[model samples]
Target: MVRGRFAPSPSGRMHLGNLFCALLSFLSVKSRGGDWILRIEDLDTARCRPDYARQVEEDLRWLGLAWDQGGSAGGPDAPYFQSRRTAFYEEALGRLREMGLVYPCFCTRAQLHTASAPHREDGLTVYPGTCRGFSPEDIAAREAAGRKGALRLRVPEKSITFTDGHLGEVTEYLPTDCGDFLLRRSDGLFAYQLAVVVDDAAMGVTEVVRGADLLTSTPRQLLLYELLGLPAPEFFHFPLLLSPDGRRLSKRDGDLGLAALREKDSPEEVIGKLAYLAGQNPTAAPRTPGELIEHFRWDTVPRQDIPLPPGLF
Candidate 1:
């Protein structure tokens, strides 16, 4: 059976963009008689709060988008929160260590910024592998200096290719793009790339539908899947919902959040507007989750970032 999931971080209130992704993921699985999972990506314990996670569940329930497993619902894979799944990530990291594919990186944010790392088109600074060659003495000296290091996976000089359900074939080179990315941070929290791959594989998720902003990071996750001996899932990266000013919608935009929208609009109206924006509906008329499933076509979703229509907020 096909299994899909919507993993949301509970750092803030659910915004329209987040709801749109959740709705699409729910429809994608439900329409095909598959199971829909809701995983709380609360790996950043410093930012993620219990209240926000509770509100996320309430918001989804209010929107009529329910999941078959995960979140409040119990499944074979218990404890859906990423924070609670650190042991799994540690085990995976241990395996990588056994294979000598993991290394300690002592590069600080300032040091990384000053390093000669290449820049991606999206403006992300690629790691320059400064500490990849650190000897035991160098590591010991750094530790003695009270500088803890993050664990980085040694990415080989090779290319990774995958076909996105919406964006078609996508390819990225490891060395030039992002060299020796982090698996565990100096703060001891598992990085997103490693945690996501381990969780998806363990939960038996066959498909991943998320925003196009993460398209570039998929290659790194694919490498983790290969190294960890996990099955890779199909990916669907839909266009991002941009602000009126063409910026990607974020929690900082309080007015565009679902909590703000709930005070003025009904759930159907919100879903309807997002469906129209996704190009799956002819007009922005209110429709139930089930009603929009028949029209949910991957081809219908726009490939480019969609700017929010004026007054939609």
Candidate 2:
């Protein structure tokens, strides 16, 4: 069975962009007689809160975007939250370690962002393998010097190419595109790339529907899948729903978060307006998720970032 997941990081309340991703993921999976999983990505407990996660569940329920499994609605795969899945990440990291590809990286942010550092077009400063060949003695010396290092995997100078379900072909060269990315943070936390891949594979997720802003992350994730010997899911990264002023909406700024929007609009009203914004509805009239599914088309959804119509709410 084809299973898709809507994994959201609950650092804040759900915004329009968050809603856009949730709605599209739900519709795409449901339309195909597949199952949907709602995984709460609370790996960063410093920012993630129980209240925020509860609010996300409340918002999705209000819009009637029901999931077959995950979160409070548990399935065969219990403990859907990332915070509860550290052991899995550790095991995967251990596999990489056993393969002799893992190494300690003590490079500071300033050192990495130097003027001579190679950067991808997306502005991610490539890790120049500065600590790629660190020996146990070198690591001990750095530790003796009162310095800690994050763990990085050694990546080959190879290109990873994959076809995105919505955007077609995509390619990324590892050495320059995003060389030897982090598997764990220096503070002893698992990286998002590693955690997500582990959780998805364990939960049997076959498809991933998320925002277009995460398109560049797919190749790195694909590589992780290859090294871990896990099956990678097909991706469909939808375009971002921009603010009226053409700026990306942030949960930090409370940009049209559902907590406040729900007070002013009915659930159907909110879902309908979101549908209109995604080109799935003819007008911004009240409509339930059930009503919008008949018109939901991957091709009809705009391929580029869409700016909200000012004063439409």
Candidate 3:
């Protein structure tokens, strides 16, 4: 059976943009008779609160986006919360170490983001491979000076290409596009790339549908999947929902969040308006998830970032 999931990091209450993703994910899976799993990515223990995760479930329920399994009502995959899944991450890290693909990187944030370091338009500092060739002496010197190291996966120069379910063909070179990315941070927490891939494959996720913001991260994950001998899932990178001024919506926008919206509009009203934004509903009239499932089509969704009307809030 086809399977999909909504893995949200519960740092704050979900906003209008978050609803856009969940509604589409639910509709996409329902249209295909697939199971939907809701996994709370509360791995960042510092920011992810239990109350926020509970609020996430509450908000999803209010919006009528029910999952077949996961979260509190766990199925075959129990312990859906990422915080409780460190052992799995450890095992995967162990495998990478056995394959000799893992190395320690002692670069500090300031050092990595120095003026000489290359950056993408989004200001992501491309890993400079500064420690790729680190000798035992170099490691000893860093440790002696009390500089801890984060684990980095050694990447090949090979090109990775995959056809997205929605965006068509996308390709990226591993070397320059995504340098030896992190496996685990110096704080000993697993990086998102490794954790997400490991969890999805372990949980039997067949397809990954997310915003285009994550489009660049896919190639890095594909490399991990290949190295780990895990079958890569199908991917679909869709457009993001932006604010009226063209900024992408985030948890910071409380006015456009689920809690605030629920106070003003009925659940059906919110769902209907979101469906219209997703290009599923012809008009933003009140409609439930079931009402729009039959009419849902990925082709109808916008190919570019959608700017929400100023009056949406």
Candidate 4:
């Protein structure tokens, strides 16, 4: 059966953007008679909160999302937190290192920012290969000098392309667009791309269903899979949930979080509004998760951002 997961970071409360992803992931698996897994991506020790994690579970349950495995809800694949998988990251990092795909980058954030200041795409920073030429002796000298560096995966200066089920064929330039991405931070923490690629492989995840915000990172991930001699999972990137102002919703939208809405105790109305935001008619408000799933149409999901309804709460 098709296997998927809803992996959320416990950095903050689940807001409208998160709700859209949760419902989409649940239905994506259910629609195919597949299993949905709930994975807590709480590896960022600096920001993850236990209370926030608890609320994530509660919010999904409130929205009627059930995972067949993982996390507090339980399944065969226990230990869902990424923080618990340090050894896995180390092993993957070792593999990439052995393959000569990963190298230590000594450039500081200030240096990177200065080099990237000239280029702009998607309103995000594009990394420059400032440290791509660091030699082994240079690395050793820096290490001897007690200098710590972030490990970067060198990208080929070529166009990378992949077929996304929802968005069709997608392409991006790795050299000019993506540059070298961090695999392990100087702070001794594994980067998200490195950790996620490793965890998904270890967990036997066959399909990845997430928002389009991550679409641009697929090629870099594909390179990691190739370097590790592993097959990349199929991808489906749905449209992002946007605010009424046409901007993508973020954790800053605390007002739109389910917990805030639950204070009103209008589960029926909340689901109806979320369903509508997901591009469904919601002709009659559905009372349960199962009922909402009954009317879910994967095809009806719009490729463009779904604007939040005005005064939704």
- Stronger candidate by lDDT (1 vs 4): 1
Cα lDDT of model 4 by residue, 4-115, tens digit: 8899999999887887788778777777777888889998888999888888988877766777888786655568888888888899888877878788888777877784
Best by lDDT: 1
- Give one digit per residue, the lDDT tens place, for model 1 in 1-313: 8999999999999998899899888877776778999999999988999899999999999998988889967589978988888999889999999999998999879988874778788888888888989999999999999999999989999999999988999888899887789898999989999999999999999999999889999999999999888999999999999999999989999999987899999998998899899887788999888898876788888999999989976
Regions of candidate 3 where Cα sits further than 4 Å from its true position: none
Report every candidate's CA lDDT: 0.90, 0.89, 0.89, 0.80
Candidate 2 positional error at 252, Å: 3.3
Please give, for residues 1-313, the per-residue lDDT of candidate 3 as tens digits: 7898899999999988778888888888889889999999988999999999999999889888889999999889778999999999999999999998999999888899899887765567789999999998999999899888999999997999999999999888778877899999999989999999999998899888888889889999999999999989998877999989999998888889877898899999999898988899888899999999888889998999999987965
TM-score, candidate number 2: 0.97
* Residue 307 miss distance in model 1 (angstroms): 0.7
Candidate 4 clashes: the total is 0
Candidate 3 residue 282 C-alpha distance from true site, Å? 0.2
Tell me how far the alpha carbon of residue 128 in candidate 1 is from the true structure, in angstroms, after superposition: 1.1
TM-score of each: 0.98, 0.97, 0.98, 0.93
For candidate 2, lDDT tens digit of each residue in 187-238? 8888889999999999999899999888998998999999999999989989
Q: Mark the regions of model 1 whose C-alpha exceeds 4 Å error after superposition.
A: none
Cα error of candidate 2 at position 22, Å: 0.3
